[model samples]
Target: MSKPRKPKGRPVSGWLVLDKPFDFGSTEAVSKVKWLYKAQKAGHAGTLDPLASGMLPIALGDATKTVPYVMDGRKIYEFTVAWGEERNTDDLEGEPTQTSDKRPAEEDIRALLPKYTGVIEQVPPQFSAIKIAGERAYDMAREGETVEIPAREVEIHRLTLLKAETDQAHFEVECGKGTYVRSLARDMGRDLGCFGHIAGLRRTLVAPFGEERLVPLEKLVALEEIEDVEERLAALDAFLIPPVEALTSLPHVRISDDQVRRLRAGNPVILRGRDAPLPTPEAYATSISGELVAIGAVEEGEFRPKRVFG
Candidate 1:
Protein backbone atom coordinates (compact mmCIF):
# COMPACT_ATOMS: atom_id res chain seq x y z
CA MET A 1 0.00 0.00 0.00
CA SER A 2 1.19 3.51 -0.82
CA LYS A 3 2.00 5.85 2.04
CA PRO A 4 -0.44 8.73 2.66
CA ARG A 5 0.70 11.95 1.04
CA LYS A 6 0.90 15.22 2.91
CA PRO A 7 -0.57 18.36 1.39
CA LYS A 8 1.88 20.71 -0.33
CA GLY A 9 1.65 24.45 0.31
CA ARG A 10 3.95 27.44 0.23
CA PRO A 11 5.61 29.00 3.28
CA VAL A 12 4.10 32.31 2.19
CA SER A 13 3.81 35.19 4.62
CA GLY A 14 1.87 38.52 4.98
CA TRP A 15 -1.74 39.65 5.35
CA LEU A 16 -4.76 39.42 3.05
CA VAL A 17 -7.69 41.77 3.68
CA LEU A 18 -10.65 39.60 2.79
CA ASP A 19 -14.07 41.11 2.03
CA LYS A 20 -15.84 38.21 3.70
CA PRO A 21 -19.20 37.37 2.16
CA PHE A 22 -22.44 37.14 4.11
CA ASP A 23 -23.50 33.69 5.51
CA PHE A 24 -19.80 32.60 5.49
CA GLY A 25 -18.20 31.76 8.83
CA SER A 26 -14.84 33.35 9.72
CA THR A 27 -13.04 30.01 10.05
CA GLU A 28 -14.27 28.84 6.65
CA ALA A 29 -13.30 32.21 5.15
CA VAL A 30 -9.78 31.85 6.59
CA SER A 31 -9.52 28.27 5.25
CA LYS A 32 -10.55 29.27 1.73
CA VAL A 33 -8.02 32.13 1.59
CA LYS A 34 -5.27 29.96 3.11
CA TRP A 35 -5.79 27.38 0.40
CA LEU A 36 -5.79 30.07 -2.27
CA TYR A 37 -2.38 31.27 -1.12
CA LYS A 38 -1.19 27.72 -0.24
CA ALA A 39 0.18 29.21 2.98
CA GLN A 40 1.92 27.14 5.66
CA LYS A 41 0.20 29.13 8.45
CA ALA A 42 -2.88 31.35 8.71
CA GLY A 43 -5.09 33.20 11.21
CA HIS A 44 -7.55 36.12 11.40
CA ALA A 45 -7.61 39.35 13.42
CA GLY A 46 -11.35 39.39 14.21
CA THR A 47 -14.21 36.91 13.96
CA LEU A 48 -16.96 38.19 11.62
CA ASP A 49 -20.29 36.47 12.13
CA PRO A 50 -21.54 34.16 9.37
CA LEU A 51 -24.54 36.41 8.87
CA ALA A 52 -22.27 39.51 8.72
CA SER A 53 -19.92 40.51 5.95
CA GLY A 54 -16.89 42.77 5.29
CA MET A 55 -13.28 43.46 6.35
CA LEU A 56 -11.82 40.19 7.72
CA PRO A 57 -8.03 40.45 7.90
CA ILE A 58 -6.44 37.05 7.15
CA ALA A 59 -2.82 36.79 8.25
CA LEU A 60 -0.47 34.19 6.86
CA GLY A 61 2.83 32.84 8.31
CA ASP A 62 4.89 35.54 10.08
CA ALA A 63 1.95 37.92 9.91
CA THR A 64 0.07 35.67 12.34
CA LYS A 65 2.62 36.72 14.98
CA THR A 66 1.13 40.22 15.00
CA VAL A 67 -2.55 39.27 15.18
CA PRO A 68 -2.84 40.33 18.84
CA TYR A 69 -1.93 43.92 17.94
CA VAL A 70 -4.53 44.00 15.18
CA MET A 71 -7.22 42.55 17.44
CA ASP A 72 -6.43 45.20 20.04
CA GLY A 73 -7.01 47.92 17.46
CA ARG A 74 -10.28 49.83 17.19
CA LYS A 75 -13.02 48.62 14.84
CA ILE A 76 -15.85 50.35 12.98
CA TYR A 77 -19.15 48.65 12.20
CA GLU A 78 -22.31 49.76 10.39
CA PHE A 79 -25.37 47.71 11.26
CA THR A 80 -29.14 47.76 10.81
CA VAL A 81 -31.56 46.72 13.52
CA ALA A 82 -35.09 45.39 12.92
CA TRP A 83 -37.57 46.69 15.47
CA GLY A 84 -40.75 45.16 17.02
CA GLU A 85 -39.17 41.76 17.77
CA GLU A 86 -36.37 40.42 19.93
CA ARG A 87 -34.46 37.25 18.97
CA ASN A 88 -32.89 34.64 21.23
CA THR A 89 -29.47 35.06 19.58
CA ASP A 90 -29.65 38.87 19.26
CA ASP A 91 -29.44 38.56 15.47
CA LEU A 92 -31.82 37.80 12.60
CA GLU A 93 -30.69 34.14 12.50
CA GLY A 94 -32.33 33.39 15.88
CA GLU A 95 -35.95 32.63 16.71
CA PRO A 96 -38.14 35.48 17.98
CA THR A 97 -38.45 35.47 21.75
CA GLN A 98 -40.48 38.65 22.24
CA THR A 99 -42.33 41.37 20.34
CA SER A 100 -43.63 44.87 20.94
CA ASP A 101 -46.07 47.25 19.24
CA LYS A 102 -44.05 50.40 19.97
CA ARG A 103 -41.57 52.19 17.74
CA PRO A 104 -39.46 55.00 19.12
CA ALA A 105 -39.51 58.33 17.24
CA GLU A 106 -36.33 59.64 15.52
CA GLU A 107 -35.71 62.10 18.36
CA ASP A 108 -36.15 59.34 20.93
CA ILE A 109 -33.62 57.11 19.08
CA ARG A 110 -31.17 60.04 18.91
CA ALA A 111 -31.58 60.62 22.64
CA LEU A 112 -30.70 56.99 23.37
CA LEU A 113 -27.41 57.17 21.39
CA PRO A 114 -25.60 59.20 24.06
CA LYS A 115 -26.31 56.58 26.73
CA TYR A 116 -24.60 53.90 24.61
CA THR A 117 -21.70 56.14 23.57
CA GLY A 118 -18.47 56.57 25.61
CA VAL A 119 -17.50 53.95 28.21
CA ILE A 120 -20.29 51.60 29.31
CA GLU A 121 -20.87 48.05 30.53
CA GLN A 122 -22.21 45.51 28.03
CA VAL A 123 -23.32 41.90 28.42
CA PRO A 124 -22.61 39.74 25.41
CA PRO A 125 -25.45 37.82 23.81
CA GLN A 126 -26.15 34.33 25.13
CA PHE A 127 -25.20 32.91 21.73
CA SER A 128 -21.70 34.38 21.68
CA ALA A 129 -18.28 32.71 21.38
CA ILE A 130 -17.48 33.57 24.99
CA LYS A 131 -16.25 30.68 27.09
CA ILE A 132 -18.40 29.19 29.82
CA ALA A 133 -16.96 26.29 31.84
CA GLY A 134 -14.38 25.54 29.12
CA GLU A 135 -17.19 25.22 26.52
CA ARG A 136 -18.55 27.93 24.19
CA ALA A 137 -21.48 30.00 25.42
CA TYR A 138 -23.19 29.46 22.09
CA ASP A 139 -22.88 25.70 22.45
CA MET A 140 -24.56 25.86 25.89
CA ALA A 141 -27.27 28.15 24.55
CA ARG A 142 -27.92 25.81 21.58
CA GLU A 143 -28.28 22.94 24.07
CA GLY A 144 -31.11 24.94 25.73
CA GLU A 145 -29.16 26.07 28.79
CA THR A 146 -29.49 29.62 30.11
CA VAL A 147 -26.13 31.40 30.00
CA GLU A 148 -25.65 34.48 32.11
CA ILE A 149 -22.59 36.36 30.99
CA PRO A 150 -21.15 39.11 33.13
CA ALA A 151 -21.27 42.71 31.95
CA ARG A 152 -17.89 44.21 31.12
CA GLU A 153 -16.76 47.73 30.27
CA VAL A 154 -16.24 48.56 26.57
CA GLU A 155 -15.39 51.88 24.88
CA ILE A 156 -17.73 53.17 22.22
CA HIS A 157 -15.99 56.15 20.60
CA ARG A 158 -18.79 57.06 18.21
CA LEU A 159 -22.41 55.99 17.80
CA THR A 160 -24.20 57.82 15.00
CA LEU A 161 -27.73 57.18 13.86
CA LEU A 162 -27.52 57.02 10.07
CA LYS A 163 -31.20 56.54 9.23
CA ALA A 164 -34.52 55.49 10.77
CA GLU A 165 -37.78 53.88 9.71
CA THR A 166 -40.81 52.63 11.62
CA ASP A 167 -39.55 49.03 11.66
CA GLN A 168 -35.81 49.42 11.13
CA ALA A 169 -32.89 51.68 12.11
CA HIS A 170 -29.37 52.08 10.65
CA PHE A 171 -26.36 53.19 12.65
CA GLU A 172 -22.56 53.31 12.67
CA VAL A 173 -20.35 52.48 15.64
CA GLU A 174 -16.66 52.88 16.31
CA CYS A 175 -15.53 50.96 19.37
CA GLY A 176 -12.61 49.37 21.09
CA LYS A 177 -12.02 45.63 21.46
CA GLY A 178 -14.74 43.38 23.01
CA THR A 179 -17.68 45.58 21.99
CA TYR A 180 -20.53 43.50 20.56
CA VAL A 181 -22.88 45.26 18.08
CA ARG A 182 -25.56 42.63 18.67
CA SER A 183 -25.64 43.46 22.35
CA LEU A 184 -25.82 47.16 21.55
CA ALA A 185 -28.78 46.69 19.21
CA ARG A 186 -30.53 44.35 21.62
CA ASP A 187 -30.20 46.77 24.53
CA MET A 188 -31.22 49.80 22.44
CA GLY A 189 -34.47 48.07 21.52
CA ARG A 190 -35.17 47.27 25.16
CA ASP A 191 -34.49 50.86 26.21
CA LEU A 192 -36.72 52.24 23.45
CA GLY A 193 -39.66 49.98 24.43
CA CYS A 194 -39.59 48.22 21.07
CA PHE A 195 -37.69 44.93 20.91
CA GLY A 196 -34.96 44.71 18.28
CA HIS A 197 -32.27 42.41 16.87
CA ILE A 198 -29.43 42.99 14.45
CA ALA A 199 -30.89 42.52 11.01
CA GLY A 200 -27.63 43.28 9.15
CA LEU A 201 -24.04 43.62 10.39
CA ARG A 202 -20.95 44.73 8.45
CA ARG A 203 -17.52 45.63 9.75
CA THR A 204 -16.15 48.51 7.66
CA LEU A 205 -12.81 48.99 9.32
CA VAL A 206 -10.22 47.35 11.56
CA ALA A 207 -7.21 49.56 12.26
CA PRO A 208 -4.31 49.21 9.75
CA PHE A 209 -6.92 48.11 7.20
CA GLY A 210 -10.07 49.71 5.79
CA GLU A 211 -12.60 49.25 3.00
CA GLU A 212 -10.13 50.31 0.29
CA ARG A 213 -7.81 47.36 1.06
CA LEU A 214 -10.47 44.63 1.16
CA VAL A 215 -10.24 42.02 -1.61
CA PRO A 216 -13.36 39.99 -2.34
CA LEU A 217 -13.39 36.17 -2.18
CA GLU A 218 -14.45 36.07 -5.81
CA LYS A 219 -11.11 37.63 -6.85
CA LEU A 220 -9.10 34.97 -5.00
CA VAL A 221 -11.30 32.25 -6.48
CA ALA A 222 -10.42 33.50 -9.92
CA LEU A 223 -6.70 33.17 -9.19
CA GLU A 224 -7.19 29.57 -8.00
CA GLU A 225 -8.50 28.50 -11.40
CA ILE A 226 -5.31 29.56 -13.18
CA GLU A 227 -3.21 26.54 -14.27
CA ASP A 228 0.20 28.18 -13.87
CA VAL A 229 1.28 28.17 -10.23
CA GLU A 230 3.89 30.93 -10.57
CA GLU A 231 1.55 33.20 -12.45
CA ARG A 232 -1.23 32.59 -9.97
CA LEU A 233 1.03 33.16 -6.97
CA ALA A 234 2.47 36.33 -8.45
CA ALA A 235 -0.99 37.67 -9.09
CA LEU A 236 -2.09 36.74 -5.57
CA ASP A 237 1.02 38.32 -4.06
CA ALA A 238 -0.20 41.69 -5.27
CA PHE A 239 -2.85 41.61 -2.55
CA LEU A 240 -0.38 41.01 0.30
CA ILE A 241 0.12 43.76 2.89
CA PRO A 242 3.64 43.48 4.32
CA PRO A 243 3.76 41.73 7.68
CA VAL A 244 5.49 44.70 9.33
CA GLU A 245 2.72 47.04 8.17
CA ALA A 246 0.65 45.63 11.04
CA LEU A 247 2.80 47.62 13.47
CA THR A 248 2.26 50.98 11.78
CA SER A 249 0.37 52.39 14.76
CA LEU A 250 3.27 51.70 17.14
CA PRO A 251 6.24 53.99 17.62
CA HIS A 252 9.23 52.68 15.67
CA VAL A 253 12.94 53.15 16.31
CA ARG A 254 15.54 52.56 13.62
CA ILE A 255 18.41 50.22 14.53
CA SER A 256 21.83 49.64 13.05
CA ASP A 257 22.83 46.36 11.39
CA ASP A 258 24.67 45.35 14.59
CA GLN A 259 21.55 46.12 16.64
CA VAL A 260 19.46 44.15 14.18
CA ARG A 261 21.84 41.19 14.66
CA ARG A 262 21.58 41.58 18.43
CA LEU A 263 17.76 41.78 18.31
CA ARG A 264 17.52 38.66 16.10
CA ALA A 265 19.80 36.89 18.62
CA GLY A 266 17.44 38.02 21.44
CA ASN A 267 19.78 40.56 23.02
CA PRO A 268 19.19 44.09 24.29
CA VAL A 269 21.06 47.07 22.77
CA ILE A 270 21.46 50.57 24.16
CA LEU A 271 19.87 53.37 22.10
CA ARG A 272 21.61 56.77 21.99
CA GLY A 273 20.28 60.36 21.90
CA ARG A 274 19.87 62.56 24.95
CA ASP A 275 17.57 64.95 23.03
CA ALA A 276 15.41 62.29 21.34
CA PRO A 277 11.94 61.57 22.66
CA LEU A 278 11.77 58.47 24.83
CA PRO A 279 10.09 55.50 23.20
CA THR A 280 7.07 53.81 24.76
CA PRO A 281 7.92 50.71 26.80
CA GLU A 282 6.48 48.65 23.95
CA ALA A 283 7.52 49.74 20.45
CA TYR A 284 8.50 48.41 17.06
CA ALA A 285 12.25 48.28 16.33
CA THR A 286 13.17 48.15 12.68
CA SER A 287 16.36 47.92 10.68
CA ILE A 288 17.80 50.98 8.95
CA SER A 289 16.86 49.11 5.75
CA GLY A 290 13.17 49.48 6.69
CA GLU A 291 12.66 45.83 7.66
CA LEU A 292 11.15 44.89 11.03
CA VAL A 293 13.74 43.49 13.38
CA ALA A 294 11.79 42.85 16.55
CA ILE A 295 8.98 44.02 18.79
CA GLY A 296 10.73 45.13 21.91
CA ALA A 297 10.38 47.08 25.13
CA VAL A 298 12.55 50.06 26.17
CA GLU A 299 14.02 49.44 29.61
CA GLU A 300 16.66 51.79 31.03
CA GLY A 301 17.44 53.19 27.55
CA GLU A 302 17.93 49.66 26.19
CA PHE A 303 15.83 48.04 23.46
CA ARG A 304 15.06 44.59 24.79
CA PRO A 305 13.64 42.16 22.27
CA LYS A 306 10.33 40.59 23.23
CA ARG A 307 9.57 38.92 19.92
CA VAL A 308 12.03 38.83 17.00
CA PHE A 309 10.73 38.65 13.45
CA GLY A 310 13.28 36.16 12.17
Candidate 2:
Protein backbone atom coordinates (compact mmCIF):
# COMPACT_ATOMS: atom_id res chain seq x y z
CA MET A 1 0.00 0.00 0.00
CA SER A 2 1.13 3.54 -0.74
CA LYS A 3 0.52 6.71 1.25
CA PRO A 4 -1.81 9.25 -0.34
CA ARG A 5 0.25 11.76 -2.30
CA LYS A 6 -0.61 15.36 -1.45
CA PRO A 7 -1.01 18.05 -4.13
CA LYS A 8 1.99 20.24 -4.95
CA GLY A 9 0.43 23.52 -3.69
CA ARG A 10 -2.83 25.43 -4.00
CA PRO A 11 -3.37 27.02 -7.40
CA VAL A 12 -5.88 29.60 -6.16
CA SER A 13 -5.05 32.07 -3.36
CA GLY A 14 -6.50 32.08 0.23
CA TRP A 15 -6.10 31.72 3.97
CA LEU A 16 -5.23 28.86 6.33
CA VAL A 17 -5.90 28.61 10.06
CA LEU A 18 -2.90 27.62 12.12
CA ASP A 19 -2.64 26.44 15.71
CA LYS A 20 0.37 28.58 16.52
CA PRO A 21 3.08 27.35 18.83
CA PHE A 22 4.00 29.20 22.00
CA ASP A 23 7.26 31.20 22.15
CA PHE A 24 7.02 32.10 18.45
CA GLY A 25 6.35 35.61 17.23
CA SER A 26 3.63 36.08 14.62
CA THR A 27 6.12 37.57 12.15
CA GLU A 28 8.53 34.66 12.56
CA ALA A 29 5.84 32.05 12.00
CA VAL A 30 4.40 33.91 9.06
CA SER A 31 7.78 34.23 7.40
CA LYS A 32 8.43 30.50 7.70
CA VAL A 33 5.05 29.44 6.29
CA LYS A 34 5.05 32.02 3.53
CA TRP A 35 8.42 30.73 2.38
CA LEU A 36 7.38 27.09 2.67
CA TYR A 37 4.24 27.65 0.63
CA LYS A 38 6.16 29.85 -1.84
CA ALA A 39 3.30 32.34 -1.53
CA GLN A 40 4.07 35.69 -3.13
CA LYS A 41 2.38 37.33 -0.18
CA ALA A 42 1.09 36.40 3.28
CA GLY A 43 -0.07 37.93 6.56
CA HIS A 44 -2.09 37.00 9.67
CA ALA A 45 -5.72 37.98 10.26
CA GLY A 46 -4.87 39.12 13.78
CA THR A 47 -1.91 39.03 16.13
CA LEU A 48 -1.40 36.87 19.20
CA ASP A 49 1.22 37.52 21.83
CA PRO A 50 4.19 35.14 21.70
CA LEU A 51 3.05 33.48 24.93
CA ALA A 52 -0.48 33.16 23.61
CA SER A 53 -1.14 30.40 21.12
CA GLY A 54 -4.00 29.13 18.89
CA MET A 55 -6.05 29.93 15.77
CA LEU A 56 -3.74 32.26 13.81
CA PRO A 57 -5.20 32.75 10.33
CA ILE A 58 -2.57 33.01 7.58
CA ALA A 59 -3.59 34.49 4.25
CA LEU A 60 -1.86 33.34 1.07
CA GLY A 61 -1.34 34.98 -2.34
CA ASP A 62 -4.44 36.82 -3.46
CA ALA A 63 -6.14 36.00 -0.20
CA THR A 64 -3.78 38.40 1.49
CA LYS A 65 -6.00 41.10 0.03
CA THR A 66 -8.82 40.00 2.29
CA VAL A 67 -6.80 40.40 5.44
CA PRO A 68 -8.83 43.39 6.59
CA TYR A 69 -11.99 41.28 6.52
CA VAL A 70 -10.41 38.77 8.90
CA MET A 71 -8.70 41.48 10.95
CA ASP A 72 -12.10 42.95 11.84
CA GLY A 73 -13.51 39.56 12.78
CA ARG A 74 -14.31 38.91 16.44
CA LYS A 75 -11.94 36.66 18.38
CA ILE A 76 -12.49 34.01 21.06
CA TYR A 77 -9.85 33.15 23.64
CA GLU A 78 -9.43 30.89 26.66
CA PHE A 79 -6.93 31.99 29.25
CA THR A 80 -5.75 31.27 32.75
CA VAL A 81 -5.15 34.40 34.77
CA ALA A 82 -3.14 34.01 37.96
CA TRP A 83 -4.93 36.21 40.44
CA GLY A 84 -3.60 37.95 43.54
CA GLU A 85 -0.37 38.75 41.68
CA GLU A 86 0.52 41.55 39.33
CA ARG A 87 3.14 41.79 36.60
CA ASN A 88 4.55 44.78 34.78
CA THR A 89 3.37 43.39 31.43
CA ASP A 90 0.30 41.55 32.73
CA ASP A 91 1.57 38.19 31.54
CA LEU A 92 4.19 35.60 32.38
CA GLU A 93 6.79 37.56 30.41
CA GLY A 94 6.81 40.37 32.92
CA GLU A 95 8.31 40.50 36.40
CA PRO A 96 5.94 40.34 39.32
CA THR A 97 5.14 43.83 40.48
CA GLN A 98 2.95 42.82 43.42
CA THR A 99 1.27 39.82 45.08
CA SER A 100 -1.42 39.29 47.64
CA ASP A 101 -1.85 36.65 50.28
CA LYS A 102 -5.59 36.87 49.78
CA ARG A 103 -7.53 34.77 47.27
CA PRO A 104 -10.86 35.42 45.57
CA ALA A 105 -13.37 32.62 45.87
CA GLU A 106 -14.64 31.05 42.66
CA GLU A 107 -18.02 32.57 43.34
CA ASP A 108 -16.37 35.93 43.70
CA ILE A 109 -14.73 35.62 40.32
CA ARG A 110 -18.06 34.52 38.79
CA ALA A 111 -19.94 37.45 40.26
CA LEU A 112 -17.27 39.92 39.22
CA LEU A 113 -17.06 38.75 35.58
CA PRO A 114 -20.41 40.22 34.49
CA LYS A 115 -19.12 43.70 35.14
CA TYR A 116 -16.65 43.30 32.25
CA THR A 117 -19.17 42.18 29.66
CA GLY A 118 -20.61 44.51 27.02
CA VAL A 119 -19.00 47.86 26.16
CA ILE A 120 -16.40 48.94 28.69
CA GLU A 121 -13.36 51.14 29.09
CA GLN A 122 -9.87 49.64 29.31
CA VAL A 123 -6.34 50.97 29.45
CA PRO A 124 -3.89 49.06 27.30
CA PRO A 125 -0.75 47.87 28.99
CA GLN A 126 2.18 50.25 28.56
CA PHE A 127 4.08 47.34 27.06
CA SER A 128 1.89 46.95 24.01
CA ALA A 129 1.94 47.61 20.24
CA ILE A 130 -0.17 50.74 20.59
CA LYS A 131 1.67 53.77 19.24
CA ILE A 132 2.49 56.71 21.52
CA ALA A 133 4.25 59.87 20.48
CA GLY A 134 5.05 58.34 17.07
CA GLU A 135 6.83 55.39 18.72
CA ARG A 136 5.57 51.99 19.81
CA ALA A 137 4.30 52.00 23.39
CA TYR A 138 6.24 48.84 24.17
CA ASP A 139 9.43 50.52 23.04
CA MET A 140 8.93 53.40 25.43
CA ALA A 141 8.04 51.09 28.29
CA ARG A 142 11.17 49.00 27.69
CA GLU A 143 13.32 52.14 27.80
CA GLY A 144 11.90 52.88 31.29
CA GLU A 145 9.59 55.66 30.20
CA THR A 146 6.69 56.21 32.53
CA VAL A 147 3.64 57.57 30.77
CA GLU A 148 -0.04 57.29 31.52
CA ILE A 149 -2.11 55.98 28.60
CA PRO A 150 -5.72 57.04 28.64
CA ALA A 151 -8.44 54.42 28.81
CA ARG A 152 -10.30 53.69 25.62
CA GLU A 153 -13.56 51.89 24.89
CA VAL A 154 -13.38 48.18 24.04
CA GLU A 155 -16.22 45.72 23.77
CA ILE A 156 -16.20 42.41 25.61
CA HIS A 157 -19.16 40.63 24.12
CA ARG A 158 -18.87 37.56 26.32
CA LEU A 159 -16.54 36.86 29.24
CA THR A 160 -17.23 33.74 31.23
CA LEU A 161 -15.28 32.57 34.25
CA LEU A 162 -14.93 28.86 33.58
CA LYS A 163 -12.97 27.74 36.62
CA ALA A 164 -10.90 28.92 39.57
CA GLU A 165 -7.75 27.30 40.86
CA THR A 166 -5.86 28.12 44.07
CA ASP A 167 -4.11 31.03 42.33
CA GLN A 168 -5.66 31.27 38.91
CA ALA A 169 -8.97 32.02 37.23
CA HIS A 170 -9.69 30.35 33.90
CA PHE A 171 -11.87 32.23 31.47
CA GLU A 172 -13.22 32.23 27.94
CA VAL A 173 -13.78 35.46 26.09
CA GLU A 174 -15.37 36.38 22.77
CA CYS A 175 -14.58 39.97 22.10
CA GLY A 176 -14.56 42.52 19.36
CA LYS A 177 -11.36 43.36 17.55
CA GLY A 178 -8.91 45.56 19.51
CA THR A 179 -9.99 44.14 22.90
CA TYR A 180 -6.78 43.48 24.82
CA VAL A 181 -6.85 40.31 26.93
CA ARG A 182 -3.73 41.51 28.75
CA SER A 183 -5.57 44.54 29.99
CA LEU A 184 -8.64 42.45 30.72
CA ALA A 185 -6.71 40.39 33.25
CA ARG A 186 -5.11 43.44 34.85
CA ASP A 187 -8.34 45.38 35.20
CA MET A 188 -10.11 42.29 36.41
CA GLY A 189 -7.61 42.17 39.27
CA ARG A 190 -8.29 45.77 40.29
CA ASP A 191 -11.98 44.97 40.27
CA LEU A 192 -11.37 41.94 42.52
CA GLY A 193 -9.20 43.75 45.07
CA CYS A 194 -5.98 42.05 43.97
CA PHE A 195 -3.52 42.04 41.12
CA GLY A 196 -3.36 39.48 38.29
CA HIS A 197 -1.47 38.49 35.18
CA ILE A 198 -2.15 36.01 32.42
CA ALA A 199 -0.70 32.61 33.22
CA GLY A 200 -1.82 31.00 29.96
CA LEU A 201 -3.65 32.29 26.90
CA ARG A 202 -5.01 30.54 23.83
CA ARG A 203 -7.13 31.84 21.03
CA THR A 204 -9.82 29.35 20.06
CA LEU A 205 -11.37 31.20 17.17
CA VAL A 206 -11.10 34.27 14.95
CA ALA A 207 -14.54 34.69 13.51
CA PRO A 208 -14.58 32.29 10.51
CA PHE A 209 -11.69 30.10 11.67
CA GLY A 210 -12.11 27.76 14.62
CA GLU A 211 -9.87 25.40 16.58
CA GLU A 212 -11.23 22.35 14.73
CA ARG A 213 -10.00 23.80 11.42
CA LEU A 214 -6.59 24.70 12.81
CA VAL A 215 -3.42 22.85 11.71
CA PRO A 216 -0.47 22.77 14.04
CA LEU A 217 3.01 24.02 13.08
CA GLU A 218 4.56 20.55 13.30
CA LYS A 219 2.03 19.18 10.82
CA LEU A 220 2.54 22.12 8.43
CA VAL A 221 6.34 21.90 8.58
CA ALA A 222 6.29 18.29 7.40
CA LEU A 223 8.05 18.37 4.01
CA GLU A 224 6.29 15.13 3.17
CA GLU A 225 2.96 16.98 3.12
CA ILE A 226 3.91 19.34 0.32
CA GLU A 227 2.00 17.49 -2.34
CA ASP A 228 -1.54 18.90 -2.74
CA VAL A 229 -0.78 21.59 -0.20
CA GLU A 230 -2.51 24.03 -2.54
CA GLU A 231 -5.82 22.39 -1.76
CA ARG A 232 -5.45 23.73 1.76
CA LEU A 233 -5.76 27.34 0.62
CA ALA A 234 -9.12 29.05 1.11
CA ALA A 235 -11.14 29.85 -1.99
CA LEU A 236 -10.81 33.24 -3.70
CA ASP A 237 -14.47 34.06 -3.07
CA ALA A 238 -14.14 33.34 0.63
CA PHE A 239 -13.80 37.07 1.20
CA LEU A 240 -16.98 37.89 -0.67
CA ILE A 241 -19.40 39.99 1.35
CA PRO A 242 -23.15 39.79 1.00
CA PRO A 243 -24.65 41.43 -2.09
CA VAL A 244 -26.30 43.90 0.24
CA GLU A 245 -22.80 45.26 0.84
CA ALA A 246 -22.38 46.17 -2.80
CA LEU A 247 -22.60 49.80 -3.89
CA THR A 248 -25.89 51.09 -5.22
CA SER A 249 -25.69 52.22 -8.89
CA LEU A 250 -22.75 49.89 -9.54
CA PRO A 251 -25.28 47.17 -10.48
CA HIS A 252 -23.59 43.91 -11.34
CA VAL A 253 -21.10 44.01 -14.15
CA ARG A 254 -20.29 40.58 -15.50
CA ILE A 255 -16.61 41.34 -15.91
CA SER A 256 -15.50 40.59 -19.44
CA ASP A 257 -11.96 39.56 -20.17
CA ASP A 258 -11.32 43.23 -20.99
CA GLN A 259 -12.91 44.55 -17.80
CA VAL A 260 -10.88 42.12 -15.78
CA ARG A 261 -7.82 43.54 -17.51
CA ARG A 262 -8.75 47.15 -16.77
CA LEU A 263 -9.62 46.35 -13.18
CA ARG A 264 -6.33 44.49 -12.92
CA ALA A 265 -4.64 47.69 -14.10
CA GLY A 266 -6.19 49.41 -11.03
CA ASN A 267 -8.89 51.34 -12.82
CA PRO A 268 -12.31 51.81 -11.17
CA VAL A 269 -14.56 51.09 -14.10
CA ILE A 270 -18.17 52.23 -14.08
CA LEU A 271 -20.99 49.81 -13.23
CA ARG A 272 -24.32 50.40 -14.93
CA GLY A 273 -27.75 50.39 -13.22
CA ARG A 274 -26.18 51.27 -9.83
CA ASP A 275 -27.62 49.78 -6.58
CA ALA A 276 -25.08 48.41 -4.16
CA PRO A 277 -25.33 48.40 -0.40
CA LEU A 278 -24.05 51.70 0.92
CA PRO A 279 -20.27 51.71 0.62
CA THR A 280 -18.93 50.41 3.90
CA PRO A 281 -16.42 52.21 6.10
CA GLU A 282 -13.85 50.63 3.78
CA ALA A 283 -14.94 49.99 0.21
CA TYR A 284 -14.35 46.79 -1.78
CA ALA A 285 -14.53 46.10 -5.49
CA THR A 286 -17.31 43.81 -6.78
CA SER A 287 -17.71 42.50 -10.27
CA ILE A 288 -20.79 43.31 -12.37
CA SER A 289 -21.87 39.87 -11.17
CA GLY A 290 -21.10 40.77 -7.52
CA GLU A 291 -17.93 38.75 -6.91
CA LEU A 292 -15.35 40.71 -4.94
CA VAL A 293 -12.43 41.77 -7.14
CA ALA A 294 -10.65 43.93 -4.61
CA ILE A 295 -11.32 46.03 -1.54
CA GLY A 296 -11.77 49.75 -2.11
CA ALA A 297 -12.07 52.85 0.01
CA VAL A 298 -14.73 55.36 -0.96
CA GLU A 299 -13.68 58.98 -1.50
CA GLU A 300 -15.87 61.66 -2.99
CA GLY A 301 -18.51 59.11 -4.08
CA GLU A 302 -16.06 56.94 -6.02
CA PHE A 303 -14.61 53.64 -4.89
CA ARG A 304 -10.83 53.47 -5.25
CA PRO A 305 -9.17 50.07 -5.18
CA LYS A 306 -7.08 49.29 -2.16
CA ARG A 307 -6.14 45.61 -2.32
CA VAL A 308 -6.92 43.82 -5.59
CA PHE A 309 -6.44 40.27 -6.87
CA GLY A 310 -7.29 38.14 -9.91
Winning model by lDDT: 1
Tens-digit lDDT string for candidate 1 (1-310): 9999765788788999999999999999999988888898899998999999999999998889899999998999999999999999999899999999999899999999999999999999999999988989999999999998999999999999999998999999999999999999999999999999999999999997888999999998988788999999999989999888899887788889998998899999999886333767788888888987888788788888888886
Please give the RMSD of candidate 2 to the true structure. Answer: 7.7
TM-score, candidate number 2: 0.78
lDDT of 2 by residue, 1-310 (tens): 9999764544345666778999999998888877666666678878889999998888776676667667777889999998888998999999888888887888888888888999998899988988887888899999989757889998899999888888888899999989999999998887788789999999998876656777788876665354554444332223322322323323332444555667778876554445543444465565566565766655444455666666
lDDT of each: 0.92, 0.75
Q: Which one wins on TM-score?
A: 1
Model 2 residue runs over 4 Å out of place are: 1-12, 224-262, 265-292, 297-306
Worst lDDT run of 10 residues, candidate 1, spans: 273-282
> Total clashing residue pairs per candidate?
0, 19
